[model samples]
Target: MMERVHVLVVAAGRGSRAGEGLPKQYRVLAGRPVLARTLEAFVDRDDVAGVATVIHADDRALYDGAAAGLAGRDRLAAPVTGGATRQDSVRAGLDALAARGAEPDDIVLIHDGARPFAMAELVARAIAAAARFGAAVPGCAVFDTVKAVDASGRITGTPDRSGLRAVQTPQSFRFGLIREAHGRAVAEGRHDLTDDAAVAEFAGHAVTVFEGDPANTKITTSSDLQAAELRLQTALLDVRTGQGFDVHSFVEGDHVWLGGVKIPHTRKLSGHSDADVVLHALTDALLATIGDGDIGSHFPPSDMQWKGASSDRFLRHAVERVRARGGVIANINATIVCEAPRIGPHREAMQKRIAEIAGIGPDRVGITAGTSERMGFTGREEGIVAWGLATVRLPVTAD
Candidate 1:
């Protein structure tokens, strides 16, 4: 039989513990939403066939807002409404899958949306064990000593920790088996199971333990969020960077385009097209890093068709070029130099224009003014000068 597995993401928690005023799954970690990063891990893995997230019925706005800007949003299965308890939410998720004609015996991995740090190894191990045992859970052997406490908070007795292990999810299972397990529990009027593994055990199923990453801790408190943020920041640091620089001198024209915006200037860059130096340089740098051809190759200035073209189109074309090569813009730092028409007043507008055209945020694109110290052509007001450095996230390639 063909293997087609789907993940059930339980994100309906109100997160009373974390106290971040947002659901634990929706909390902002670093610059991205917590659950977005969680979903990305599996979505990037080719082994996962599908994904379905469970959320509170009333959190539609929050869910949509967070889901936007994610790398692979189309692959995400429609979210199902969750219930009061975590067990209820899981059952609801199963029902949603059943309505879609999912097979009972098919593989399904149930994961906590709060545990964004769950590594690919843990996922692989759980899937491996589940395929063999019908059910598999992730855990680490209990390391510290344990004690049984009384109502007065005094140690009533000491318990052995040698045989105990703390389990984590995504707990993998045969979909048909887990659905039946939940149905049986509801019929039995019992609903207090801690995790999916416990539910399977109650249904006479054996769940094997696979070693899990210690970093895969649930986000229950502020400290947990802080730790997750730190891990995510470290991951973001390895992001790729690309650089570009372009210069254009004064030509007899009515207007000049800077960063995709037309500005009133006595002289425009001398080119066959509306030579926007800022956009041209940024585009050249972006394409340069991806090994894509320069603007001359894509839209040659020698061609009359590009004459008087809006610089916005040039920027958009450049952005599409980068995305086509599976890379993303990290940051853009561009400098504009000229003796006339101060660039300070237009800095914010230029940055906004660049960000919009580049498909990035205003924060990711920056603009600075440069003077030739009244010594060079720019200082003499004979021409204008512009340069840009574009940093992009280019996927690693095997040489």
Candidate 2:
């Protein structure tokens, strides 16, 4: 049977070391509070049964605002007000969960609120380990040379860093074991602690460690924050941001046209097809969304099959490929981003055209316009460049 999960996130740190005006957990990183990232890491996982956050009483406003924009925000259990020391605060959190009727044997992940970079797979690993071994935590191999230094700043013998390790949060446990461990630690007057491992060890329970992501570093000192920023940036680079530029230079021919239909212009566009850039880019984007080949692969440039063919036909064909695989357009937000003819007046018409070609609702088709302040080829009015995002949802069964 699957263990009922009640992940307890501890976010009451005052963050005196970072020296920010607000608590470190509430501080904004990558447009959301640090704690929001941690909560989302839990909410995104299908195995996480529930979540309980322990925060400073005064931080309710910050918490609410930060958690607003994330999907599945309702999964967060009600806030528990924390106590003086870290251990006291943890006891208060556990009590709050018990007050909320969390079962004794359910697993609880006691994660540091400041560590926001834990990935979904890491969370799953902790849960699986907890189920098998009774407790687990993500840890990285120690890199620096360990040493036992004296109070007088004299060097002691250098110790081996190979066997040493640095532990990170999302520490997993059998709920009853952790609660009992904390209670015993309090009774024994053992208060010098920084992590749940110490408490569990004192209670005579065996704990296991697994390989952790190097990116999962706790945000404490200013240098740590910088390191976190670098990791976050690295992760975000996977979004595959691309600025696509396509321009059909004016050629000696008939009246000019763009976006499938004819628009009054001085000269016609020269391309293998009707040269509707908006539609072509949208077709390519649909292909990109599915991780298939590009637009050129589906319709080669040299093929007379598409010569002078309406660009709408190309987009419609791409839509069919997605539909054949049981995929539908979730949303398509695009920008014309040019300085040629005014796109504002034709924006709605463009949306209508794209909706028909994409086989999606007009509401799902979005368009925005911007000029480059006369900086590049687009600013010089040489051509129009467009950028867009197409989000697709994978097929899934209801639980």
lDDT of each: 0.78, 0.73
Worst 10 residues of 1 by lDDT: 232-241
Tens-place lDDT digits, model 1, residues 134-239: 8889988888888899999999887788888889999999999999999998899879997899899998888888888887888889888988767655544435
For each candidate in turn, the TM-score is 0.68, 0.60
For all the candidates, what are their Cα RMSDs to the real structure? Answer: 6.9, 13.1
TM-score of 1: 0.68
- Please write out the lDDT profile of model 2 over residues 1-399, one tens digit for every residue: 877887889988798998767788877664346787677788645667778888887888777655543444456777888877788888888888888777777888889889887877888788887888887777899887778889998888887888777898888888888888999999999887778888899988998998788878788976777677655554443232222335565566555445555666655667898877777777777767667776788899899999988887777766656544435456666667556677777777877667656645557777888899998877876666666567654344244
Question: Which residue pairs come into collision in candidate 2?
Answer: none
Clashing pairs for predicted structure model 1, backbone only: 104-176, 242-390, 242-391, 242-392
